[model samples]
Target chain A: MSDDNQHQETFEDFKNSFNYGSRSDLNFKFLKNLSGEDASHFFQELLWKIGDSFNDGDFTRVVDHVNETQAKAYAGVGRFTYDDSPFTPLRAPLSQLRLGLMTSSGHFVAGDDPKPFGVENMSQQEAETRIDDFLKVEPQLSVIPMDTSIEKLRVRHGGYDVRASMADPNVNFPISRLAELQAEGRIGELASDAYSFVGAASQLRLLNHTGPEWVRMFQEKKIDALLLVPV
Target chain B: MEAGGIPTVVIGVHAFRDRLAAMRLPRTVITPHPMGRTLGAPKDDETQKQVILAALDLLETAQKPGKIIDLPGRYRL
Candidate 1:
């Protein structure tokens, strides 16, 4: 099917799931206000909101205040698929496995090598202006090894508040905490390096291409287990 | 790449736990926190360590793949 039809079907499915039992006119009217891309982003955020409330069993209440007929629409698109590599279990004990940290928070330290996003050196205003450009920077086509220490680390992500992470990089990356774990013998060893990149980009090409490539890089470290921290 | 012989686990907020489970990557631990502060509030070493330990524990105790364990606490910005 063409992209237009697929988007229409997606909107229809979202309307059915979200506004069930509501008036058809109201549902279609709300959907009609949205462009195809907006419809997709709405569905994505709506799903995240739903996922947050899944444990409460109060999902019906969550949607009750959506104001179906009067909601404004914006433009953006996102999609997710379930296709993934097969599952692999941790065969070795924690004390015997090597661990690594990978984050989407886009961390770097001063005096380190330059990164793709270039936001680390940009002024706040410049970074904000160039946010979309950073998303296009798929450094190394996957994950890039971060050469940073706790004292030198700085947070450069544009998608979320970076204050917490800047004050203490462990807020997002948790490298210091992980090292403490290693010292305590809670884990065997820490990888010589960690990985980071700005992840709020809406690019599926980077997501799909990075998975296998990330695995290849981590494998070189003989990393027995990995901790994926997504923002 | 869990299927490629390296076991992996994800740490994210409750908002993305379902998709993480659906992704079927491996084990996942959801915390009731914001996106950037996945481990917990900054400077809270004890709580942060606990969160990491909980997720790492799931790496071993999860009976099946795609299991999501909720860390016991709330950290709201």
Candidate 2:
């Protein structure tokens, strides 16, 4: 069939397609917006796509299109950091901070440290008052382009050194130089501002909670770019 | 990084995209496998660029302040 004669299937064409990638922790409402009949039809087609991975090219094209959209639309993006912190007692690292706040208040960044809100150094009255005020950053973290010579974007999945359950993504030399790039101020040149750990395949529980929070937090922060590097 | 923010693009699998769309979050799908593996080939800049560019398309044509677009099909490199 010609492209025009062929019907274009939408996400709604499926009953329960995989919601397992970026924001896997969402309260899904894909079919809720449509009537029961339409929802049924959506699922019908989705099942067809699943049974036959026949449209790989079409899917790839769409993926390419979305990639372009992300670049042109946002001010900047960053990878959700997944490294095991050198700092001991860093509970969940960046994902923890970002997800905890979102799951808790649905408003705070995933990386916002709530520890200061729970400090015993303050009085009860002071502590209670500081709870809300503490979230707002004094001097918010900002992304500035690194003035170093650059050819391409490279990053390690920062978490490989931390989590045992994860794989060693073992990126090339370019990706491995993330720290050097950051130090040289070259990381801020592209759309994504930071490099995220792309190596954790075993932290599904944490990812299910934290990854979504990162996406939500980035949106709230008005971050336009996102990068994930597997170790 | 300590780097300043830039209009970013993330290439993700369709599953992740659907989840985001369901939750009303905004992001683009690269229709690949799970996270971490962008182009399937490790550190292959050529494949990675193709994948990255796919994610960039969403940023380019996103009309409204908030929108979630289902990318066309699966991605292979």
Candidate 3:
């Protein structure tokens, strides 16, 4: 095949292999808009980074490359930071402490109707299509009971691909694994309710208001330690 | 939540180490997994359970804030 044909074939393979949602379409369009040479370079770099991960069993390089590209694309956007790190020593032994689970994977119980960021009454497709608008609103939290079946869980995040999490909520929200640990006596107990929220929201709101509110709820439950899974 | 007296540990992907560091969380366990599968690959109950245990270990042992531990493993899928 000619070089042009080869690049086109590779791009086609990439499109087929990447099974993300609407945001992926935006990424595809962006790639399509690039000049032929620029597109080839982009794909080459991406493949190289992916290969590096497989070779070294580390993904930091791939992740850094993507982050750098995104940083360049949104150069002026500010990133969130904190000046202080708060620490509360575990007061009880691991086997005796009541554990709480939380995830930013945007998971909720089926039929719970969690309107993340106040985007109410929209299907998953609608929420994804308007994800940019959703990112601007205050973060919302969903409570998933500890014993909720995996079949009753659903995810609605727009930050990254949610398909893996949709297929298996334990990928990001490992409530079942925590319950198993509790059963094995690795922990004293599991909180009756776990918390979740869409992480791709206004961090200011989460840091100042919503996060504290969630903390208060955990406090009310007398949770001794928490396990947070961020997707 | 650590500020509220409820100790917390975060299980995250290694790709976001800088972002996680900037957040200044109390304890963190960074795993060599993809973005969506922070704990492990889908349906891999063994790896998932191991990741959870690692986080729980950090909760019990980490003495200072901003403690980030890298769980040694590659993505299986």
Off by over 4 Å in 1: A1-78, A83-85, A113-120, A139-148
DockQ in order: 0.38, 0.13, 0.55
Worst 10 residues of 3 chain A by lDDT: A69-78
- In terms of TM-score, how similar is model 1 to the real structure? 0.69
Tell me the spans in candidate 2 whose CA falls farther than 4 Å from its real position: A1-188, A191-193, A197-231, B1-8, B65-77
Q: Report iRMS (Å) of candidate 3.
A: 4.0
Cα lDDT for residue B73, candidate 1:
55
In the range A1-231, model 2's lDDT, one tens digit per residue, is 468668775554432332222322112223334455755655565566554546553454443443333222221223342222111121222221221001111111133322333443333234323333533322112122222223332221211111111122222112323333334443333223332322222344344654455556566655434443222
Ranking by DockQ: 3, 1, 2
Q: What is the lDDT of residue B58 in candidate 3?
A: 87
Q: Which of the two candidates, 2 or 3, achieves a greater DockQ against the reference?
A: 3
What local lDDT score does residue B72 receive in model 3, on the 0 to 100 scale?
82
Best by TM-score: 3
lDDT of 3 by residue, A12-73 (tens): 44543333332254223334334456556766888998998898888776655553443233
* Predicted candidate 1 versus true structure: per-residue lDDT over A156-191, tens digit per residue: 665566777888888779988988899999999888
Q: Using lDDT, give the best candidate's number.
A: 3
lDDT of 3 at A135: 71
State each candidate's chain A TM-score: 0.59, 0.22, 0.70
